[model samples]
Target: MKKLLIALLTAASLSACTTTESFVKGADVGWLPQMEASGYQFRNRDGKRQDALRILKDYGINTIRLRTWVNPSQDKGSGHNSRDETVAMAVRAQRMGMRIMIDFHYSDSWADPEKQVKPAAWRGHDFAQLQKDVYDYTYDVMRALQSAGVAPEWVQVGNETRTGMIYPEGHTDNWPQLAKLINQGYAAVKAVSPSSKVVLHLDRGNDNQWFRTWFDNAKANGAKWDVIGMSYYPYWLPGRPDYTASIDDLGRNLNDMAARYGSEVMVVEVGGEDDRPQNTYDMLVAVQAKVRAVPGGKGLGVIYWEPQGARSWSHYALSAWGADGRPTKAMDAFLRQP
Candidate 1:
């Protein structure tokens, strides 16, 4: 789907009715299939077990986020998030009338600010070869998704990459190399689907200074991206500030990023502990409101990260599903009318 602003401009003439754009109320349920495979079931409000996608849809979620890891099989117990598996998940999500956001880890496993392990195949390659590898891998993934009729609406070049992606070569300290890799991914996404918005993601939703430093260097080095994606986990973010302060800070930071980059922003990942369902619900409510209040409606969306994850491999604490298989109050936040 086209972005909010682009989709709203219907004609040059004034109309009595204004077309309101849809906000992306989304969920990063990348672990849903895997959790089901491990015998975890998700129950609807009626307590009846249902397909994960159906349950999310019933709760009013309009988008799904999936992460892709290259050569995941390079290590034992890896490969579950391989390109093929990601494509299958995207197909299912699209079939359910949900838009898709593909997040590229660009590694064999999780690639965060602290750890961005290089894919085994590209470890020994020189800088030029590494750039080509990134371009080819990204183009191939986009082509496969397109062929399967699951082309994504948004594509993230990397995940929670505050420092950068693909350790050493593409690390934040090496801004030129990092920007080249990011530009490669952006070009690949456009080559396959011009409508797909490319996102440059980073963690820390409240850190405006971090965003300025990172984005300044990226733009100076010619990085190409359309949207700014941020991960906001209140319980896990550094400092553990009060919820109200965190929400206010996030709003300020988002506005700054949108104004600076002239791009829309989204909380691509967000979660809070399930132990306090009410607290999580309140946080989500505030966050949704804050995002919508961004100047010029530049705030695009908010996505819950692994909201239905039960018995997660990582023992995640922020999932909204209780042990009884039913969703917690946190999921209801998405039901709020915009």
Candidate 2:
């Protein structure tokens, strides 16, 4: 049945629109999974994962990226998030035949460009202690996955690590320490699953200097990785509203990085839904068209970020965006991709 689905997708790709030129196609194309992805942020509830996995499979998604934190709710006025929740999600997604990727934030709370708060448990640790903390955290996570039979195929050492992770001590400002911590995460992942592809990710996919600088420093200090992943959202990235130019820049930048770092690239997170679903969808389709046009861009998949945010479920008309929200135009963009 999967084979047949692949054949049908292949035929559809060949004949679907018949306007855009086919850049390349290999035997791996059929076996290659189409990336129609979304996020499944859970509240540590049991038995909900089965339904979530079913929804993903029904949506033709084949990959699941789960985020892990050391301890999300140990502080006052803070909420709780558990690795057990993430592992449960991975197990369910795997049961549904979805490829798994584990995102190690190496922090207690949300780890993004703006936030990289160290886990309370690791605070006040020296450089050596920080390295040990990183290794133990990563190892323990992977070990938990292995013991629970939920090993991920890909392991991301950190989140949108724009300025490095485990800040102050191992932040990007200190390449020496940042590289050390990153290397520790890399070694830990390899220790558990030698075959898993380790991905080193960053924000600003279109920024030549950002990618070059980060990877150059990382490579110089021996940051092992199998993939150069990025997070691109035109709506949020610092650039003009010229989406076409932005995507064209993405292609050129990615090609440059591929040549420089010798790694496969993936846009691990994306999607935008403004005030209107139709307009959002239109913007997304145009963006997706340009994104898919990137050279060697066939396998590049995107994960819709919080497409179904909490407040927008029923009366999505909270303020500007539409009340009727589901996949939105951003999703339509993916549907129209090669």
Candidate 3:
């Protein structure tokens, strides 16, 4: 009877241990709540920066990530945001106790794997000078933010730079120059504030090979980075290779990145909320679960690009309807986490 009791007690203790580990892993995993986690994705509409700020503060988000284009030439009959405009928003974020993360796109418009249209002013600059352009622009922005009392917590040298930022020049497959230019921006950011952490980002977290190829080259050339950031938009990543295999593959790959790079891995930008929030919300929750469940996965946290913007177009077209949308389902997803 005593042996039976002992066995039962041991089983109960093990069950309790399992429960404790599960709860802590989900709650205490490195979750950086940045307002711009995926907020605008390069387009800021209706001066919605203020609304962005309020939502973040309400949700305990301590970080704000903002992207900048070198000279995003008035695309589609719209004015591009300038350095001064970025600083202005950074100051507003500061007033509310949020740390800024500056993202340099290094182009006239967008800079990613799919698109990187060089600025018209930079058309004449050679590779050597192009590297300088990246460093100089990064330095100038940091200086302005410093003077304005809005120091950045982290600065991303470039966005979705799987192939490296700045095309035909700073582009990878030309690793010698590519890595050097990346280091130049890193140096520029360091020159101003050595304490600020530098983040190196890439898209398609599902592609371990993409990260491996880039980081392997970067390591060969000695890249400087504090955090490894990945962007995972559910609709986008699954189509990359094999959908059935890729989801689990991404979770494993992220764990591998943290160990391989020896850097804290941050999802940095992730989104859900399809044409409607129900399906996407569930997907986000499942991704969150996957991260927390995996033993080696440091899974920082999943961020919604623009949960509020899911139905934004309808509102702008008609002032009569007003905003009936709140991030009710999205918020519930995070809150419902087990």
lDDT of 1 at 239: 76
Q: Write the per-residue lDDT of candidate 2 for residues 1-338, one digit (tens) a residue.
A: 99999999999888865542322110000100111122333221222333433433343455777677788764321333357767776776677666778888887767888888888998877889889999998998899899889777778898888888888886877888888888899999999999888888888777878889889889888777888877766667655364555777776776777667667666676545455556556655554454455456533555544443423332322111133323333333434535
Highest-lDDT candidate = 1
Clashing pairs in 3: 72-108
User: 69-172, model 3: which lDDT tens digit per residue?
Assistant: 66654442123446776777778777976666777877766678887667778788988888788788889999998999877867888888987777777778
Each model's lDDT comes to 0.86, 0.64, 0.64
- Please list all clashing residue pairs in model 2, or write none if there are none: 275-321, 281-329, 317-323
**What is candidate 1's lDDT per residue for 225-252, written digit by digit as tens?**
9999988887876676657767888999
The prediction achieving the highest TM-score against the true structure is: 1
TM-score of 1: 0.91
What is candidate 1's local distance difference test score?
0.86
**Which whole-number lDDT from 0 to 100 does residue 36 have in model 1?**
67
Clashes of 1: 0
Every model's TM-score: 0.91, 0.76, 0.75
Model 3 scores worst on lDDT over the 10 consecutive residues at: 24-33
**lDDT (0-100) at residue 336 of candidate 2?**
52
Q: Is candidate 1 or candidate 2 better by TM-score?
A: 1
Candidate 2 all-Cα RMSD: 8.4
